[model samples]
Target: MGNGISNVKPSTERSEGGEHSNSSHPHKLDQFRYKVLKAATGKFCSKNLAGQGGCSDVYKGWLGYRTATPGCGLPVAVKRIKKQGYQGLDEWNNELRILSSFHHPNVVKLLGYCAEGVHRMLVFEFMCNGSLEENLSRECCREVEWSKRMEIAKGLARGLEYLHNMDPPVIHRDIKSANILLDHDFTPKIADFGLSRFGPQGDKTHLSTRVLGTEGYFAPEYIGTGHLTLKTDVYSLGVVLLEILSGLKAVKRYPNGRRIELSQWATPYLNDKNQLHRVIDKRIIKNVDMEEAYDFATIISQCLTQDPRRRPTITQVLHSLQHIESKHQHFA
Candidate 1:
């Protein structure tokens, strides 16, 4: 488990229809001129800044439909690399390569890229609603109600299911809420493929790789042993679902100067149906259906199991969520 990954396989599946998915049979990726991207982002102005990562800064920009020129088509996010080191360049290339192969609705679309001189950037569809983590924060938690949370959860499951079912399969090493983007319609899209890796195939059970991901979202086994599997994503998904239900961050600092993981803090409420209310987000508490919430909690409990082998597959999780959604619709 030391980043000595090898024998990885790539996906050959093609998307039938999508905005950026309509490229070509061999996955034609757009190559954006640095000047064009700069113009689209108003010269990478601070006002257009959307996010900042350790190795890159993201700016919101608008480009032409066919030409991808400045301010004539659709809004997009431009992630510009700030570090030229090996690690930074590696992540950037990895994201570009991996995103070029994906065309799922629940996964973020890589519109194009810019690799000019010392500058390296990746362009993506700008998620209007922002990341799930941003929406769940204290300032905006109320905006995402009970139904929307369920929808987001299901969308995330679908995205993970698609990745897991790919030809060689993809393991999104980083699956935290911050990496889950939301569209104008609140459709959740899995983002940040910089740390993704191809999962084990055929006779292999798991891939031994370096452990890299958000601290709280790391699966127990992954953190301890660095064995990567599809179930690892499921465990991270459960942490995210817990955050959605409780309006809590994966890790938080308690008043006593100690930090606690959300799963450990919410275990009591998740384990006992009668105590579920104690952990429900106060902002959406009034609108939540206790029974439905309990069912959702049950699924989360199964996902958070320490034993990766015991966790339910993404498909199973999606089915359970769909069942809950159908029940809600019937009663409505």
Candidate 2:
């Protein structure tokens, strides 16, 4: 098992009214009936089960491309929360409220939702490529070449920049690779907003909230004091960068029963340009340009900086990634 621990503690600080605020209004999103989703997913058959999390089960479904009616046009993912699961009605409401308010190409699209009776479900555009976590595993790493990996990184940065630059700013409390899905073209889309919240507003430097997030992805400061900041996401982004570069999970356990955190294990190599190749995944290393790999390493190091304040903004990270892509023919 990889080091994916979910600390589902909700934040104590509530966001004020704004674009990022949890509001009752769902805007333009369709209100899908439970029956519609049930039919689309074949009554949540095991064969249609795309994936399962601690809180929900995701099933593959089909809907009309234009009208979004069941069993007609495009394939979709239907996420239904289990009763007495880790995530409850509150998370369902929060995800619906937040996602409905915003739309971005790099962020997953919430096509519709169902809140009928005791059921809660969300319908999203189907991602043919699945989660980045799946693609990066040893069995599938070959599918994602170095260029695709860099593009995925850029797309994630773009998504995070969009979230962080909102009117009141938004913080994705969870920002691991598993939450990042790849479309048919391998474009990365940030998904799952059950733990998202608005960023610190006005004069506040940070929000004192419950410590929550995946274990290996949590920032030092967040884990130490439960103080949340936009940089906390940056730290997670760094862990993702390390994952992309090394083709390893944020936490990997060996046959010896020893677990190694990717960020902690790769930091020394990330800091040393000459030794940067040592941390890169061997499968893609042959085609990797040393200079480009070094540049990517530099960005990862900045994001993994011990001091949260020292981490670069998501926008800056995007610019740096774009800059690297611009100069490299290595990125196909």
Candidate 3:
């Protein structure tokens, strides 16, 4: 885990309305007919399952939102809440409450949901390219070129920036590679906001809750104290950025039987340009800009700084990425 940072202040993002407010952004929270979603997912067939997480199972589906007349259904990703306890209910409500009105090009859009009886399902635009994690797989890497990697990272940063700048900032408690989906054009969209929590309000600096997040990616402060702020999510994003550069999972066990955390294993090289070759994905080393790769490492190093107070905000991260993408020779 990264070292802890204390006394980090809440972001001063302009609060236009309270967290979960939908006054200005009045996108109707569409309620789906259980039958419709069930049909879309081929009755939740195993073959259609796209992926599974701690709280939900995502299945590929086709859905049409036409009310008056029938039309061609759009391909969709259906997230079905797994049965647990009240925790499941809370997560379902959280995704519905947050994604119902949250709209951004880089953020996944919630088409509708199924709240009938005990069934809890969320419908979203289908991402053709699976996830950033899948793309990093040896087989998939053949398709995710250097330029596409930078584009995905930049899109993820912009999504975070939008959430951070929102009135009553939204902290996407989970920001790992698996949670980032890619569309047909390889456009990135941040997903799985089930763990997301609002940023601290008024004078409060952080939200205190039970520690919950992917191992290796959770900030040390959060794991130790349950105190979460925008920085907590930023730290996770830093982990994802590092994963993108190195093509490794956040946690790994090398063949030598040495188990290591990605953040700890990659930190040293991220800070030193001279050791850049030691950390970059070998597949892309010959295909990407070395200096730009170093710059990205520097940015991730800043983000992974143990002290949350010293980490650059999402806006700054986005701008730096934009600059890199513009100048990097990814003619790949």
lDDT of 1 by residue, 1-332 (tens): 14322222234456565433323222556788998898888889888899998889999988886433455678999999885556767788788777778777899988888877677888999999999999999987447989889989999998888888776688998999999999999999999999999889789999999898888988999989989999999999999999999998999987999998999888767979889998899988999999899989989999999888899999899999999988877997
Query: Which stretches in model 3 have alpha-carbon errors above 4 Å?
Result: 1-26, 65-72, 139-141, 254-258, 326-332
TM-score of each predicted structure versus truth: 0.89, 0.88, 0.87
Error (Å) of candidate 2 at residue 71 is: 7.9
lDDT at 116 for candidate 1? 72
lDDT of 1: 0.85
Model 1, residue 90: C-alpha shift (Å): 0.7
Q: Which is the winner by lDDT between candidate 2 and candidate 3?
A: 2
Clashing pairs in 1: none
For model 3, residues 57-81, the per-residue Cα lDDT tens digits are: 9988877664222234788888998
Model 1 TM-score? 0.89
Candidate 1 stretches with Cα past 4 Å from truth are 1-26, 65-72, 255-257, 328-332
Where does model 2 exceed 4 Å of error? 1-27, 65-72, 329-332
Clashes of each: 0, 0, 0
Pick by TM-score: which candidate is best? 1
Quantify all predictions' global Cα lDDT against the true fold.
0.85, 0.84, 0.81
